[model samples]
Target: MTIKPLIILPDPVLRQASKPIERVDGELKRLADDMLETMYDAPGIGLAAIQIGVPRRMLVIDVAREGEDKQPQVFINPEILKSSEERSVYEEGCLSIPDYYAEVERPAVVTLRYLDRDGKEQIVDADGLLATCLQHEIDHLNGVLFIDHISRLKREMVIKKFTKAAKSKAI
Candidate 1:
């Protein structure tokens, strides 16, 4: 598996809706593997295909705490089946929006269904950090960002900051 370069914020690619994987072939497996590698290299808990310029409905997550055994999860074409009325706030950061984090409120519990690495369907009942992570990554598949959940003023500021950083990097 190779570590792919992450597409940062202000990259229009991140705003494009991802296409669902029609088949779980070797190529899809390779992409998932690469995504996991990239996530680990970024030292992030989760990553989406669009974050690396691959507009496919794929995501990898490993929220294991430091010192614990690594647990990698691959979700293809994931869909949220249920969400709890209770809300939780977490300081969320994205691999695409490096170095910036903001508190975002999301469902504390959620039921999600998706295809596993073996192409078998699976459903998970998630809460706490997992729920937040799932929502954040899935948002990428739908061309949404966590910043979008924040106040318009904050969202605009964050976008402007990233846009300026991107422009500086292009110099």
Candidate 2:
């Protein structure tokens, strides 16, 4: 599988809501494979399709700890069905945002419905890292970033930083 180039921060496309996948086919499967490869190459636990310039409701994740077997999962057109009122915080990072990380609070448990690579529907009740990862990726599909969950001052600072970096690179 090819490792696709990640669309980094300050890209207007990241703010665009992703469209749902119409069907699962060999081409879609190949894209998922490429997404997994790109996520692994990023050394990140999760990645959204929008991160790679594909504004499609898809994400790949593997929350396996070090030394554990990789458990790659693909979610197509994922939607959160339910979420617990209880909150949990995790220091989250994004491949698109690169090195920046911050603790963000979200539901401690979540139930999600999505189509697998085979186009079959699957519903999963997730907690801990899985829940957080799913929520983060789902937010991407909605044109939301982890930074959006943070304080406004911080979020604006981050956007400014990335915006400046982008301008410098263009020079």
TM-score of each: 0.98, 0.99
lDDT of 2 by residue, 61-125 (tens): 99999999999999999999999999999999999999999999999999999999899999999
lDDT of 1 at 102: 96
Q: What is candidate 1's lDDT per residue for 1-171, written digit by digit as tens?
A: 999999999999999999998989899999999999999999899999999999999999999999999999999999999999999999999989988899999999999999999999999999989999999999999999999999999999999999999999999
Candidate 2, position 17, lDDT? 99
Best by lDDT: 2
Query: In model 2, which runs have C-alpha deviations exceeding 4 angstroms?
Result: none
The TM-score obtained by model 2 is 0.99
lDDT of every model, 2 decimals: 0.95, 0.96
Residue 149: error of model 2 in Å? 0.4
Off by over 4 Å in 1: none
